[model samples]
Target chain A: MGFRSLKTKLLLAASLLVISSGVALSLLVSDQYSKSLIDSARHQAENLALSLAIESADKVLTHDLVALQKSLDHQMKSNRSLAYLFVVRDGQVLAHTFQKNFPQELLDANTVISEDGGNEQTIVSTTGERFIDIARPIFQGKAGLLRLGISEKSLERQVDELRMKMGLITLFILLTAIAGSLFLVKRITGPLGELARSVENIKQGSWDVKIRVSGRDEVTILAKSLINMAARLKHYTQRLENQKLELERAHNQTRIFCEIVRELGTV
Target chain B: MLFSITSIKPIAIFRVSLIIITALSNIGCSDHEQSKVVNFSNTITLEKPDTKQRGDKQLRVAIGAMVSPRESISIYQELLDYLGEKLGKEIVLEQRKTYSEINELLGKSEVDFAFVCSGPYVVGKEKYGLELLAAPEVNGSHFYNAYLIVNKDSRFNTIEDLRSKTFALTDPDSNTGKLAPIGWLKKIGEKPETFFGSLIYTYSHDNSILAVSRGFVDGASVDGLIWAYFNKTNPDLTSNTRVILKSENYGTPPVVATRQMSKSMKEAIKRALLGMRDDKRGAEILDRLMINRFVPAKDDWYNSIRDVIESAGVSMEPQDGLSKSEN
Candidate 1:
């Protein structure tokens, strides 16, 4: 709301620019970070699932069913991000790492890739948490599928952390820019305020009103202009006062002469 | 009017300056409170090589030597490639020369699946937790014989004739090569270590044939399928030997998987194998490998071979405890 000076208005405009751009940059960076986190996490999960599938192939062939179950359970314990795991053999549920509420949909799908086998999909857990379901074929499906569910929460957590950091950085940049602009505005507009203060004195014909002009910049130039204008007004006022004094003297002489002429005529 | 004209005081100039300073300070303070320096670097985006990225996972397979490593690859590489194609994963062939090595690989679960002899199948299933995947049916039978052969000129007519001569065995884990010979020796109140003057293992049926053909050993035991394979591919080796003894037919060697394999994967593999003979590429590879087609096998089908091995009760354990060179 302040149009106090051109300098002040310009400073306000610069502050607005800095804030808007900072916010825009923060949002753009946050979005990119979220996408990157999700993509990389899913890829890492895929690599791990495939390795587990390969390891389980011989164990399944050897009728070492307990080994696979125990392995899945052990992995789940160490990896908190691992939400669930199941082993299905001969179209029957053999073992799983789930505590309860097993997803029957996973088993029903068979996920059997006839020509090409490995597959992954997204799923929502019973507790309303999101997860990525990865399936790998053991012995190329000569045996069965090793299904694993990984939580997406960890990915989100990382993205959240990144966003917070970005927000802080944006705020920092914004404030720094605003402070810088305001400081510049004060330096440029200082002389204007000084001139305004002495303006009344210059208008009342007090020629002694002298403003302290600092620096050899635009402010100084404006001060010199104001000083010249005040000097001209003082000169014109002095001339007018002298003219009025002369006119008063002339009028008094005329009144005295008229009175003497009238007295002589009456005698 | 001139008296009323008063200049702005110095106090008003101070107020304007104070406002500007306060605004700048406020901006600075708020910025300090809100702005935090953050490093925007990460190490999460490395690239993977195309070769290493095969199917994004590696599945290992072992082919226990029915022959030498070179021959095994030549014979089974096509089938493994086909299987890999069907499974949509990379299949790495783990080649080991001796049946015991294959058994060890199975026991360690280092090998995902294997094509192994019937002799080693029982041993691995008992000791390494191997489950049968499928067996090859060659020439309309899912069975194989153990051939006891002698040089064409040798006067060896029966098992007793070679009692005091040097003999060659194929592999310790071989049903036909080691167990069959032991079965005969036990039946005659003798054993391989005591009955023969010297015993050497060739580690392959064809290698044993080469030993027997040149009279390096007076006699040897070999697989019937291998004998036929040699006969069809290279008749010179087979023509030089005569069958002095033949053991009863036993179930053929099978492709076995581990117990932890998923049912869907098992189903897919079984389906691919069963349908192999129907496909031209698969059939051609089967012919080159001297196999008719793969058929589903159950664990109980090899009971007769198991009985023969147990009946021998003779130590077929490796003499030097050294596996043959993979070369």
Candidate 2:
């Protein structure tokens, strides 16, 4: 039972190591991927907003709203991560990509934080969609402001995909490690089991049981020690048997001698 | 007896291997993640790098507001570059919101040459002796007309049907875009101020076209050449509109030079334009612009435009006065 429990403990220990290390590796990789993906997305958002601002300056200044609308539409087609885009001049929306009514709340939702209009905010639309609203100044605020909303949904989806992939990989590694640990436990416990059986045979007064084990490890050393003890025990048992036999023979002879004397005196 | 020693070594080895594997994996992941972020942020630059040398001789050329600014860039950037390459000078493209501003740029010699509207060319010639260099030969003709258009779905089938509806004009100093349309209105004893329910100046013919196509305005008058060009090239926009009226033909807008430009430079520019069709690159640009070639400018070609403007009782000031009042 004890030996069986030893196998259980070793298996538990191996499982614990694999699990802990796998969790740690998964966390490290997932965190890094999440951070890098978010940073890249934010940078893309900012660049897109900036380029649109640059392109929209002349159109806004000239009051060419048709051209501005065309540009906004074109830009919307190229980026799927974009939620919505518009241009605001003098607190009025000049052109927007909205197919229907423009959201009035969005105008006051995010404002330019910097003098040159590089500002951003996290906003939740009425539809429950989350976005990173980026604002940029056109002609240093002389022409207008360009407000672009980049959806965070795609980024979240990407990070989730990375985590899922990482989790599967970690699980594969854990399973392989556990299988390796099982093989190692068997290799280790196999020798100890043989030694245990030999000791049981000795307890049953059978000294002919083989206790020798082969290896350059501690188990082999233990088997060697057991073998030496068994040898001494066997020698002592043989001497004791010889002594008992002599004693029995002597006693018999004495009895017989006594009988002869008695026959002449009290046989 | 040595079971403790036996179990402890394997566990220790396992633990050590686990640690080493985790460390190596973490190292690999961190390096990859770092490189990925670097690659993502590396190529984004908002400003274009200027590759032209600063010491090069520069020629300032102004393009009038014939098309919207964005379209102007796509259409003319190459032609300007070709001109710069042939003349061995850096070309600086100047643009204005109105044709009058472009003519004013030529009036002050702020620009070496300009592509001006026929109306501005006529006014600039009388006001400042603006010399004509050459005219584009579109469909073997040096003349273009004005087109009054409405949305294809509109109930208006004629210009009179658009009496009290909204209307769009291209620019104040444009012949086909404004003068010809206003002249037709005046001939029928009506004024744009009181005739249309609302009026908006789009500053470029393409914008007017877009305005009509999108139903932002019920009617718009645009340069016929620009209308035809868009009809063929951008049918998505032009297919939404139907032309209802066509005006008498006027001189096609001409390339003009400031009086301060030397005669030799004028001749050289004329030669380059006239010979452009023979050069492969120049021929491509011309093909994109839908021009067969360039021909010598005839002064009498623009007389019809002058007659129309005069008959409409429109007196244009020679300078920024007309542009400012219209604004």
Candidates, DockQ? 0.03, 0.07
Distance from true location, Cα of B187 in model 1, Å: 16
The TM-score of predicted model 1 comes to: 0.49
**What root-mean-square deviation over C-alphas does model 2 reach?**
12.2
lDDT of 2 by residue, B1-327 (tens): 555444444466467657756774676355331110111112222222123343538888888889976567677788889888888888777777888878887998878998888999998999889999999989989998999999999989877898878888787788887788788888789877678877788888888888888888899999998899888888887999999889988889999999998898889888888989999999999999999898999999999998987787775533222222122
TM-score of chain A of each: 0.66, 0.79
Q: Candidate 1 lDDT, tens digit per residue, B113-223?
A: 788999999888888778888999999999888999999998999999998788888888899888888888888889877888888878778788888898888998999
Report how far residue B117 has shifted in candidate 2, in Å.
Answer: 1.4
Model 2 DockQ class: incorrect
Per-model i-RMS: 17.9, 12.9
